[model samples]
Target: MTKRWHSLQNDRPFRPITLLPVTIAFSSGILMGFAPAPLNFFPLAWVALAPLWVLLFTPSKAKAQGEKNESKRPFFLFSFSFGISFVWGVGYHGLALSWITGLHPLTWLGVPWLASVAIVLFCWGFITVWGAVLVALWAWLMHRLESVGVKGKGEDDAALLSVHASTPWHHLEPLLRSLRRVLLGTALWCGLEWLWSLGPLDWTALAYTQSPGNLAVLHFGQISGATGVTAAIVAVNGLLAEAWMNGQQLAVSRQRSAVSSQQLKTQNSKLKTIALLVSATILFIAVHLLGAVLWLQPIAPSNTTALKVGIIQGNVPTRIKLGSDGIRRAMEGYTNGYLALAAQGVDAVLTPEGALPFLWNEPNKLRSPLYQAVLEKGAVLWLGTFTAQKGGIARSLLTITPNGATTSRYDKIKLVPLGEYIPFQAALGGIINLLSPITENGQPGAFHQQFDTPFGRAIASICYDSAFPEVFRTQAAAGGQFILTASNLDPYSEVLMAQHQAQDIMRAIETDRWAVRATNTGYSSIVDPHGHIEWRSQPRTYQTHAATIFRRETQTLYVRWGDWLTPSLLVLGAITVLFQRRSLRS
Candidate 1:
């Protein structure tokens, strides 16, 4: 009777029957949202996922009951457990991406006040829903794998015998089982993150939560970019989840055991649970310790090459910049800032994206005082301007020599979705107006556009391109000495600027190069190869920063290997899962 009861209890799914678990999960997500920029409560991220992890690691009742039928597995997707997991994702994304609402009062874009509010809300809801849905899918996959793939496989137990045939491996079964679950969970998370990175909206990556803080963990990016830090987070969370699951099981075993042998088994389980908890704590500390070692390692010196670069931040309102009336303010602000920085003896000056309100070949641009100033300063100048191409307009950064000749140009490749160009414009253009100044879709630059500067070769990214590591990694691998990211972040809140700065810091660490950012409204900064911010500008203020930044040709492991860790882990996990199911059928 006791054995039968224990089996039944183990088979029963762990459900969020009460409001407490659901509330805790949601609250945890809210806390995690603060782990990234603006608030930067990074420590919360280390433990915030525990409740969600518990929910995901526990098998749902539907899956526990319907083990034989493949069709029945879909039932778990709609289970209450999925709802709980999704709620956490919503809570996290809602707070983290609150800056999306900064686009309010879009009257400047010819949008009515009420309509603007509705549009912003719709965008927020859509993105939040998409992010939350991904989380739910992650949880569902975890439950399905635990329930169907490896649950009752006898070969799993004997598979380890080749390593320790004579040892009492049965005594360590619980520990091994917990470790296997954690490994699988970590791999699944990394795979999901990789998928997210490929898309246009990738600001919500788990690793970004650690940036501008948690330097120890951020160092892991040097080896595997943001994916490595994400793997570490998922692994730690999985360990804690396993520990919690074991504790609950041990308590249940104590209540049900009656015979001496049963009592002995219960005591062993208790001992194993305690051991697992202790081991998990140790592993967590060890990961951070190793991270600290990596963080403290000496940064390789620049090859005797340094560029005194000046970054100009023009505090022009987005509304005016898009209008014809704001042309004077935009040109004067950049030209004046450039001249001031030039007087301070900067070798080169950089302007934020769209610094010149006119096209690159516009007659007005050549007549402007900015061109004459560039010629007189005899210093290299980089201008963020539009170039008229055969296909359409191209957002480009033009490099001008001391002789006032356009030496090189790098057109933006990763255009902002909906903001720069509307998708399915043929269908949606008539109904939905993006209110963008450009009527036609901006043309993307070639992927391998080489940017040659007076100092040397440099990696250039415009605005949204910084979010994609692959964009910078390829350039860095091609012997690019330094990184420059120019953005026009007008109208967005300072929170967005801070987040943008964090992304650049990660890119710097990943490529082992110094990064300089120039933005229209604030958070222009310089970052070292070690993910340290040397300088940052005040938001919504017209400011210029001139600093000596090094040019580094050193490529990090991530840049060389190119995000191999996450994909490799995903492939391995997939094979293991397939092997498990095949063994079950046999």
Candidate 2:
């Protein structure tokens, strides 16, 4: 163990220059963990590129002497370190919170570590491959800038010769050269993001990092689904790298000129360095301004129905959720809450998942008086419950119309792996303890479904279903102008859990639909069509707020096409990588 630790330590280089890249990468990852809840921002996103810049710019003395290929190893090491530290900090922390909530502590510890390793390896691999491509592109730009011939008469010829001694290649002007690299890099990053969206890890976009604070930048998301924000983040990182490189080159030139013999060489290097910095600053400012304008735009609500909605937050403890007596108590609590909301002149009342507590098919089930009361009050009750179906067991959102009619039912598409249904349960058998005994194991819904309400056509998503974007998008495409997400987050999640869960806000923005999230414990929020939170209940609290939300008939680019831009971008990014490799070979 001691020897293994020593080997691992030795593999990780502790150079001062490497710290910048690691810090930037790790900080960016940590920021992603806090997104879409309450504390979201893009300013700190600048730090995300620190590690990559350091790795690309910092020269290795060993590689310089041609003694060893230190470049390849350092890139991998830097990427791994950055990915591990950042993902572990951000992603694993939530798993720790799960452990404290009494989930098999061993499962929490094991699962989180495994997930962290998988995520870190995947992200690091992406950075390593892409970072190398960027480096080659930068080198090509440098070469082109050096090739730019003389421009201004005899003085231009003299300047060209002097510049060539230090920088070389006079064919490519400095501004044009920088612009080419920036454009290419931005295009590549955007493309990669688009392609990756088709995969299971589609949530890894830079926009997810800002989810916790997306409300502030809601307008920007309407045009682009977090991809636009990612472009800004990458652009900022590139600019920082350009600035740092310039400063380093200038300092080096000054030192060389002080030696007297290399004054001309030093002067030329300084000029090139200044030119690069100026070009980089201009590009950075332009992108920043563009992002600012998009972010500052107002997102107007599209629907004008003005439906009075009520949310029931039954804070039932996990231990009592499935027990016979516990089921009675859970039913009583939800029914009473619904009745109270009905009295408040609410058009519809919402409840968290499994609010019924008991299995819907259970014989001689207690019919609560709240159902009759809802009918009498002329209010629609949207209740999250469980029902037995041909698919085994399904968690469903049942709509009870004002006339006591069981009007519409939408089943949950995405089921929680362990909490709802055990994975590989047939092979594992009794090794896994089920969270509920409603059925042998709860099954996933056939597909996403939308229901026409008095307010408008609305789509329903259960707790775990909100995590998947494609599900919500399908519902929106099927004419769901409004979305209702019912979740019971009390048993396994924390207040901070809402931060991670806010990824649903992106769905609202992506689809241009108003989203109402009613969680069992807390985080009941009204997310407007543009993904902005109009109102939210306090976490871990039993509170209800009646806020009016407007639904939009207009579809966003993402909603209309669904990750089409991302896939195209991915192809273009791949082509850029190929071009970069070819350029490097030349």
Candidate models: Cα lDDT each: 0.78, 0.57
Return the top candidate by TM-score: 1
Q: What digit string (tens of lDDT, one per residue) describes model 1 on residues 1-586? A: 4343234324324433346556777898998899999788998887888778765444333434534343265566545556777899999988888888998877776778898898789888878877887777777677667655566543222232233335566667656667767777878788887888777677788888998788888877878888888888877777887777666655655676398966766676677667767866887787678778877878756548878999998888778885666887887888888899999999999888888766878576579788889988876889898999876788899899888889899999888766776667779876556444336578778887789998899999999888888889989988889998899887889899999998899888878889999999888999988889999998899999899988887778898998888878887777767765674465
For model 1, what is the alpha-carbon lDDT of residue 319? 80
Whole-model lDDT, model 1: 0.78
Residue 247 alpha-carbon offset, candidate 2, angstroms: 3.0
Residue-pair clashes per candidate, as listed? Answer: 0, 23
Using lDDT as the measure, the top candidate is 1
Model 2 bad stretches (over 4 Å): 1-42, 56-205, 212-216, 257-304, 362-370, 425-440, 446-448, 492-494, 530-532, 580-586
lDDT of 1 at 106: 77
